[model samples]
Target: MSDRDTIHAHIEAHIGEHIANIQRLVQQPSVSLEKTGLRECAALLVSNMMAAGFTEAETVDVGDDYPGVWGMVDCGKPTTMLIYGHYDVRPVGTEAWTHPPFSGEAIPFDGFPKVVLGRGAAAQKGPLQAWINAVSSILSVEGALPVNLIFLIEGAELLGSPNYGKLFERYRDRLAQVSALYGPKTAQDASGAVSMTLGYKGLIYLEFVASTQSTGLGPQGGAVHSATSVVVDNPVWRLLHAMASLTDDTGRTIAIPELAAMMAQAKPIADWERPLLDAMRAGVAGKDPNGFIPGLAPQFPVKTFKEEVAPADLLQRYMYGPSFNISGLRSGYTGPGTKSFLLPDTATATCDLRVISEVGAQDIIAIIRRHLDSAGFPDITIRVMAAYDWYQTSLESSLIRATLATLDAYDCPRTIWPVQGFGGPWAHFAKLLGIPSLQGGSPGHGARLATSDEFLVVEGDGKVASLATIERYYVDLIYAFAAVTKQ
Candidate 1:
């Protein structure tokens, strides 16, 4: 048998051990925001990497932030591949779950034949563990992989990877030698076809605060009788009016002229994006694009609603379009029942601008300030909470070609997305270090990442079906990638 066949056999032989190790990894709580079990998890990852035949593996500290784990295995190959994944997961908010969020329990559900339900099961921990398993299998069977390997797993991905760029900068010389970067693909549409996202949009998270002391538009004191509203201006009303000026009546398009101009100048759909657009159009025509996400359809303006929109238009607006979203709003009283008859002293709205490749977060914030100042709300304070620049890989890159070939080899129904609709810290390596990066892995079909019921599907047949697909895909990807000759 060929070396590739040998690797496949090894994977099949050790599949059970791989799944058990992944369960153990998922059982560890490494919530980045809460700093829960971060150090312990990093240590565990190091130990696992060492056992996988990595020559060196250690946890690198990024100032006060959570630690990032780095590992390397040199096989004397001509090419090196850098793999990136996050060890941290989103906070498990107050959502009633069927099982413990940290319990990597394999349960049999209807649509999904078998699934491992847990916090980081599908978002990353599961896929990362699968990569480790693939590496182990390949080494144990052949004593060497086709290409050199470098692993950089961070613990602050959920926190916008505030310090990841620094880590990349610190290890620039070592990282720059790598030919390409790899990450697990977590985006699956309603059709259940696994997708390879070439890039992601940038993000600017900001909070707009309007208070009597700052804006001089609302009541100066804490709480006043509702009857006093005749004389006292409500900060909530003022803030609402200011926000209204930022968006049109439809609330889908940005009304600020300068911001619109920036988006137009920065983001132009190129030829590489055609395939993604076509897939999105097909998805819109076939299924309710909004069905996978509950309660999201009604939030769109009537004209921009999915049912009312054409396929091409919907893809353009939802995928390529920039957005101004109000994540949360806080004002007077927010009790259980109702507490009326009082004017709040301050009002604040937390918003995020889903940016494109052309714009920077600081520039967007500056433009917002300019718009608000010109609109006669100069006193409003805009605080930038966090920001991440966009990243896009070339469609013709070796990494992408290898991914497409692997998916085609497995007969996995696949879609090619030019860029993900969400924001990520991929720019740290892809754009900053000048390494080509592509997100590809086994099917993460029903992993409700960032939600209370987050899970990873495991198929009964060890295939790429809903729950059983990840390990096999990683094995295929590693082999296909090794076959690619660096240009």
Candidate 2:
């Protein structure tokens, strides 16, 4: 039998085993913020990799809370394929779920088939499981993979991957060996058509605390009564005015000089986005394009929103360019009713800056500090809450070609995305280590990520991507990587 045929057979033979292992992986709670089951999750991934013929599997400890899992299967070829994914998940925010968060229950639904409801079903655990399953299935059938393989799994993805730089620095040699990188296809539409994801936007988050001395008459600094309003300058007003200087009525125009400067150099919107933007403008055509809007309003120009909010335009704004947003703010009194007092000491606001290409968090923070200082709000203190670099792979890269080939092999509809709208720390894999990273995955239809009802559909046949469908994606990927590397 042909090598491709043999790999497909192997995957088919042990499909059930793959599902059970996926359930086991999903069951482990690896919330990074709470430090819940992080190391255990890393160890679990190591075990799975080892089981899948990766002879050298080790959890690289970078110190801090959670470490990364690194493993490799050497085929003695010059070409190496690196795979990047996170093992950590975000906190289960306030949401009442139909099933327990970490139960890993694969119970049968009434009108539908069975499913695995748990934490990380869509945000990532399920897709990670599928990768492991694919590797195991290939090994079961062929006894050896076609191309050299490397696995880089981080445990602190949700916390903005703080220690990822240190880890990447330490493993530079191992990462340089990669000739191509593999990522899941996350491109999909509401109609259920699937596509491949090419790249993701980057993020830099900042928290600014504006403060002043306690403004009061008493030695103990107690707030003054309503009579003091005319004499005392409210810190809240000062903070609000300073923030107002950053943006105009329409959020589209940012007032910060340095931020505007950096954005000037951002890559022009890609061609694929035009059609999608047109679609979105048609969907939601209510708001004016020129005026500043909150929520989804900024995405579509008033004329475009008058049309529809195309899925493509929504995706483009997220993947490419720099986006600025004020995430949250805190300043004073609504206790019971209206307690008459301007907050004395401080008012703070957290801002999120999403970057596309070369914007650095530390650099951006310095620029912002300078801008605020020049704007006469030197008292506004800037803190780097989180930072993640942008990641992009050439559409013409052999890795992308291989991915497209795999999709074709499985008869999966192919809608190509230049990048995902939301940003990620994928730069830890791409820029830091020069590893190509993509954020697509088989999270599946109707999987609600971040919400409590997150669940994974499991047909009785036990195929994560429909037995025949997933097997082809795996087999084709193995074949394509092997061929590309051999050249």
Candidate 3:
């Protein structure tokens, strides 16, 4: 048998063990938001990396927040590859679940594929462990890796990676030799097709706060009876009016001048993106009459669109569209039946805007401030909660070509998303550090991320099961990338 075949054999033989490792990771609660078990999980990751034949592995202090984990394996090869992933997970709120959020329970149902139900099973821990297992299997059989590998797993991703930029700057010299960044595929559609996204949109999370203290026109000290609202100004009503002015009647279209200009500057979809966009259109068209499209429908429901839009237009809007959303709003009691009617003294609303490459958080905040002031609502303060810019890599880059070749070899259905609608810290490495990064690897389907009943599929080898597909894909990817960067 060839060396590659031997490597695959090793991976297949240890599939059970790999699943066990992933289960172990899933069982540990490493919610960064609550500062729970982060150090323990970081230490556990280091130990696993060392066992997988890394030359050195340890957790590095990013800041006062949770520390970031790092590991290196120098295989005496010229090409160096960096793998990025997060060790942190969202807090498991008091939501009902079929199984405990961190139980790592493997259950099989009649009609659906077998899966491991847990909080972090898919949004990252599963793929992270899969990569570690792939490295272990390759080394156990081949005695050495084909290229130098560097692993950077952070614990602050869910919190917008607040300290990752500092971590990268501190380790810039050591990481300068890294040629490319790649990681496991964390998303899969309802049709069970996996996607390789080349880039992601930027994000600007902000909060609009209105209080009686800031503006004497609103209620003060405490909530007054609803009857007094006639004489007193209601902060809730004032805040709602301010929010309404930001959007037109359609609600999707931004009314702010700066935001409109930024969206107008977005270049038309390029030629290379046509094929993938067409494939996405076909997938959306194939959905049941009442069924929702995988990525687009659930977020932007058909009923919510102001006008009838074609599939391609919808896809383009999702890929390149600048979005403004009200994630949450708060003012008075929202409990069960009812409480004493009163005008809330303070009203606050949380909002998020997904930006393209041309716009930024500061710019958006400034424009919103100007819009509010000019519209006669300057008392509403705009507080930035978090922010990050977006980035895209060239399709012809060596890393992307290698990734495409690897996916083709595995016979995986290839849908190349030119840009993902969500936000991430891709700018740190892709644009700031000037290294090309691509997101592809492992095939697993997950839904309800950060919500109740979150799950990652666990099953045997085949096109249907993700366990074997992920294991085999990583093995092939390592070899394919090594060949692409041969010195």
Q: Give the per-residue lDDT digits (tens) of candidate 2, residues 277-367.
A: 4544454355343331212433334455322554434434545646788878876654677766453556678778777757666677778
Greater-TM-score candidate between 2 and 3: 3
Off by over 4 Å in 2: 109-112, 185-192, 211-241, 249-252, 264-266, 269-321, 330-348, 357-362, 389-391, 432-435, 441-446, 460-464
Evaluate model 2: give its TM-score.
0.79
lDDT of each: 0.76, 0.66, 0.78
**lDDT of model 1 at residue 396?**
78
Clashing pairs in 3: none
TM for every model, in the order presented, reads: 0.83, 0.79, 0.85
* Per-residue C-alpha lDDT of model 3 across residues 1-487, encoded as one tens digit per residue: 9887887788788877888888888899999889999999899899889888889899988656688998988888888888888988889877788788899877773244577778888878888888888889888888889988988888988877767777687778878888899877565555556677777888777889888888888677778788987788988888999999999987879998866877778856778877767777776663432243334434334554544676556666777878899988988877788787888898899888887856565676788899999999999988776677788887887788887787677666757777877776666777667888976534566666757777777673244446766777788888888888873
Superposed Cα deviation of residue 372, candidate 2 (Å): 1.6
Expressed as tens digits, the lDDT of each residue in 322-391 for candidate 1 is: 7789988998888788898888898899887887856677777889999999999987888776677888
Worst 10 residues of 2 by lDDT: 290-299
| Ordering by TM-score | 3, 1, 2
